[model samples]
Target: MKTSDFHYDLPQELIAQAPLPERSASRLLHVPPGDACFADLHVRDLPSLLRAGDLLVFNDTKVIPARLFGAKATGGRVEILIERLLPGNEARAQLGVSKPPQPGSRIALDAGGEAEVLARFDDGFWQLRFQVEGPLEAWLQHAGQLPLPPYIERRPDAADAERYQTVFARETGAVAAPTAGLHFDEPLLAALRERGVQTGHVTLHVGAGTFQPVRVDDVHNHRMHSEWINVGAELVSQVRRTRAAGGRVIAVGTTVVRALESALVDGELRPFAGDTSIFIFPGYRIRSIDALMTNFHLPESTLLMLVSAFAGKQRMFAAYEHAVRERYRFFSYGDAMLLWPGEGESGSGDLR
Candidate 1:
């Protein structure tokens, strides 16, 4: 399908500049599975909306401060946005410099460190190895700034230190947060546990490519940038039990959906760990997830395409228009929607 099929007119003011005072204070648009429907609600009303048997699958991949300012040895200032970490201390990063830095050169970051360009990979990324006093991951946690989406104009403030991440964040790696998980706080998790709504976590370190715009006019031609995902025995058991009990397996975000779906093959969801470049477009089959709670996505984006696959292109776009018409905030630091799979792509669809 054409990327334009997913487009909508969003008022500039609807783009959220900041998070709400309370994590669960954001609005929630409920898109039911039918031609005759949609309802607006609050995030706080989630507990009552769920049943005891329903499982809320969340992505626990923590966002790293991946965006950094640096200078090449040639004295040109550059910005490094870490995309994926290759094995053995090497990382694939996007170099935003006056001119792209050459291979095997030393570039010093403003926060205090230098990285040696190892080699250039396919496409725009360069593989660079950082010289660190401590582990590279720990250094990023302290020195880097939150990798907020480009649409968010201001530099990340102290409040963003907490608000941009979810309460359950662990297994540090994502450059971007799994936004649908952003709505839940400690109290909300406690509430879910108290209500017998099962909760399980998997890691899918969201990459900077998550917000990368889809350049293809034909959305299906776009290839997804690979990202790491892991679904363990616990989540599998929970999903199996949830299904056995006739309960819903609600995915928290597109990240969680990819993590679960990437592990699925041959009619079974195997525990998996590796990079997944799975681009879920329209007509793709969904095996495990029954519902989704996600933030509004950018038009003509792979993320938008994924949502369109879950909910139909028409329904999802209509819901997006509704959000815009109702002034629902947009993107990562924005309001969310709880989408029951559209009537055309509901439960028991093929995984492969």
Candidate 2:
């Protein structure tokens, strides 16, 4: 399919610049497969909408402070977005500057430290060695700022530091927050538990490549960036039990979908702990995730393609049209949508 197929018109005003006052206060759009009808709801309605046997899988990957502003030795400005943190106080990051720094040149960090540009990779990221006190994580905790999505117009503030993170966040590796999980709060989790809706967690360290755009017209030519994912045995057992008990596996975000689907071995879901560059588009045979609950995505984005794959291309397009018409918020801090798998335009409302 062509990348242009996923394009849609979104008003700039509809793009949420900041999060709502409450985590569960954002709007929710429920689109059942194959119909023109959809329900307008809120994030707090999730527990009531789901059945007792339904399992809601959440991505607990914590968003780290990856954005660091610094100045070059030549007095030029530089911005570093840590894509991956390695051992030895080293990192691979997307270095932003008018003129790229030379190898061995140090950039003065705003975090009271400096990093040397060791080398540049073919992927356009620079290998950097930091001269900081204590561990890199500790240093970042005291100095780095939260990395907001590119769609956000303003700079991150105190609210973003807490709002960008989920209540269940534990693992600290992701550069971007899984926007879908941002809707959940401790009270909502308690409500889900009270409703007998089971919950599980997976970790997928989202990289800065999540913001990368598709440049090719033919989507088949596009290659997805690999991100680290971890699926423990507990989650595997939960999935098996959910299936055996006739429950639905509702993936909270696309990240969980990738992690669970990538863990499939010999047609069975197994524990996985590694990196995955799995790309899901139209015509993909999805073996995991009975439903998806996620925020609205950008026009012609890989995320939109994923939802189109999970639902149907036409179905998703129709939903986007409806969302725009209804003045629904768009992007990272935007409203959410719940979708069930169905045939594109041709089939009835039976969820696969």
Q: Write the per-residue lDDT of candidate 1 for residues 1-352, one digit (tens) a residue.
A: 6888777778888999899999999999998887767878988878877889999999998888998888987789989999876666678888888787777789887888789988887767888998876778878888888888899999999999999999999888899989899999888888888888999999998988777788888865777788888899889988988999999999999999888988887768778888788878778867669899999988777788788888887889889988988999999989999987776664332222
lDDT, residue 176, candidate 1: 90
Clashing pairs in 1: none
Which residue runs does candidate 2 get wrong by more than 4 Å?
344-352
Local distance difference test, each candidate: 0.85, 0.89
TM-score of each: 0.95, 0.96
Q: Write the per-residue lDDT of candidate 2 for residues 228-282, one digit (tens) a residue.
A: 9999999999999999999999999889988888898866999989989988877
**Top lDDT model:** 2
TM-score of 2: 0.96
In candidate 2, list every pair of residues with a backbone clash: none
In candidate 1, which residue ranges exceed 4 Å CA deviation? 346-352
State how far residue 140 of model 1 sits from its true place (Å). Answer: 1.6
